[model samples]
Target: MATLQLSGVCKSFGTTPVLHDIDLDIGEGEFVVFVGPSGCGKSTLLRLICGLDTIDSGTLTIDGEIVNDVPPAKRGIAMVFQSYALYPHMSVASNMGYALRLAGTPKAEIERRVEAAANVLRLGPLLKRKPRQLSGGQRQRVAIGRAIVREPNVFLFDEPLSNLDAALRVDMRAEIAALKQRLGTTMIYVTHDQIEAMTLADRIVVMNAGRIEQVGSPLELYRRPANRVVARFIGSPRMNLLPGALVGDPAAAEIGVRPEHVRLAGVGHGLAGTVRMVEHLGSDLFAHVEIAGVEERVVARLDGGREVHVGEAVSISVDADTSHRFDAQGKRMAPAHNDRRTA
Candidate 1:
């Protein structure tokens, strides 16, 4: 495993700057994920770490050694890309050992490493099968096994599961999680999917338009976002925002509440609105409410069995104590160092 540090990292393309003065530290054997929407530079940042691209102005150190000029092959890092990139003609064993073979590893050592990686990935039974004979998930595992054989100091994954279907994606996620436990190697993953980041990362680096927005553990980010961007992005249905005036807070521009926090208030108690729609999942029902002054529809999460219908008049209340207050500039304005917003 290796520790990675990026100080004042900046990158650009022609006249358009991508990554700003970014700084991050990754501990040895840590699983850090860079997550954000497309055009956010997550993939570019991964490429920079893999030495596929150069940092315009920054110091990238690995294991406390400055490797700004180090070649990718010498960086002790292995990267798995979105594409499987396996050779169709090569058997799984050959594909997994190809890098070692090219690196001039002895044939016997290559065989040993291949066996070890296959054992780790559970690909032993399929070693003789060509890429064409393997399933998509199996092919991806082979690609990962290819990297595992090298025993690199760090592993970098760039949206490796995005190409798979939803079910396969979930399966691959479990497999990758198991791989992390089995190897305990330093892994940096890049994904636009927040769920992937939340589930896979020890720390998630949230980015927006090439700049790092926030970095925190999954629950820390979900429960206490630093700004509106993170508050709206991290959640599955996203936190709902209403004009702070509704909460009688003149200093707050917006009052952010999660769907789960938007509870059903009694008649005329809170915002009087009509249910726009209701989405029933297994255990939760999300009701979309349209109010007079609110721009976007307010969505409230309730018990799935609750029989809410479209066009039904309802009153929904925002739990101020469970809500967040944001300044006009969208900065979180908690009352104290650790205090959340309260009525």
Candidate 2:
């Protein structure tokens, strides 16, 4: 395993700058994931670390050695791309051993390493099959196995599970998590999927428009987001943002509360609203309510089952202390004073 560090990393293609001055430190054996929307420089950041692209200005250190000018082949890193770049005619065993063969490794050594990686990835049963004969998930495993056979200092995965079906993606995600724990190598994964980042990373680096928005554990970003962009981006179904003026303090600006945090008021309750829509997800239900005075629609996640229907008048109340306050510029203010529920 190797520790990776980037200081003031900047990249640009002609006049358009894709990456700004970025600094990050990844410890040995740690799993760090970079997540962001497309054109956000996540992939470019990975390419910079792998030496596939040159940096305009910055320093990249791997295992305490400066490798800014090193060739990709000599960087001690292996990248698994989204598209499984496997050779169509080569069997799994041959593909896994191709890198070693090109490097002039002995036949016996190549077989030993290939067998080890195959065993780890559970590809031992499919060794004789070509890429055309494997399933999408299986082909991806082969791509990963090829990298494993190289015995790289760090593993770089760029949306390796994006091409799989939903079920296959879940299965492959578990496999990758298990593989990381077993190998314990430094890994950097890039993805646009927030769920993948939440489940797979020890810490997530949230990027936006060639810059980092926030870097924290999944729950931290969800619960105490630095701004409105992060609050909406981190959660499934997204957190509801209602347009409401602070009754007591004009300086408070806007209030933000999650759908799950909103409570249904019985009879004479809190804010009155007309139900716009209700979504039934079997175990949980979400109500989209339009408040009389507020312009934006508020969403409430009711526990158990649905209790209200469309066009019904209802009252909604949120634990004031549990809410988030955002300034006019969208920066998060002090958290509302409420008891936090444990996940």
Candidate 3:
């Protein structure tokens, strides 16, 4: 519905900088996710966009117009926070329609808009129930429904599913994904969960220590991280980093490999190690192998059916084509001519 852009955006609290030189372009109807560790300024950036916090410098634009001075209510954006923040005294319909009412909309129009949003969220049947009568997920739906009634140009979600249980988080994730498809509103979501960032975003903005690290599609960041920090932060079990000497690459400083790209091989064929730990996750097996010369443990993902045990001797083969090479400065190195096939 709208394009959001940030240029050299910076924010701070007192004298401590929270965001530094942040620049991003979010296209119309784009689901862009901001992901990083705690204290990484993800939420601060979201608040700046929502007008909850003012940017100390640079421009904030929505739909090609400067909105740095605009108030949150006038900025045409709706934020769904981690807390439901629904009024316990109000029924579902009243809570959802409250915003329209505050704007002096006619009672009939308020009812119409409320019912419309309820229908979309499947909250129609519970319109008359109080927030006290609802479950956690239902309350969250009410919160989302409240936002929907506003019909804003952009949606800002700040870890909206963090309060839910694991099962409900998954369910709510699917629901939010469906909501985005149905409305096609520009959305900027802030979360620390990489899985949510990977699955929900058209593009993920990876952040670290108040600075932008890399911005790309889920697979792009996973397959080719911009640097070592991103390489280690984006994956589960994390990528294994071996010294260039151990990887037989004298020109490189380190070689990185994802667990899934390494396979079990016969003894004396590849990097030999002792299986330090084995994790069976139904469909996949993750073996943390302790190599002789590598400082960090190397994890190899294999078939779950493979009977591997702790302390077992195993050889792990790295797919050179799939491996990532980094220079001494911790920057990703250009692949060798023959290794270009790894991508």
TM-score of each: 0.95, 0.93, 0.96
lDDT per residue, candidate 1, 222-287, as tens digits?
A: 988999998998988889998877656667898888999988765687778899888999799999
lDDT of 1: 0.89
Clashing pairs in 1: none
Ranking by TM-score: 3, 1, 2
Tens-digit lDDT track of model 3 for 13-59: 99999999999999999999999999999999999999999999999
Error of 2 at 91 (Å): 1.7
Which pairs clash in the backbone of model 2? 321-336, 321-337
**What is candidate 2's local distance difference test score?**
0.87
TM-score (C-alpha, index-matched) for candidate 3: 0.96
Which whole-number lDDT from 0 to 100 does residue 300 have in model 2? 90
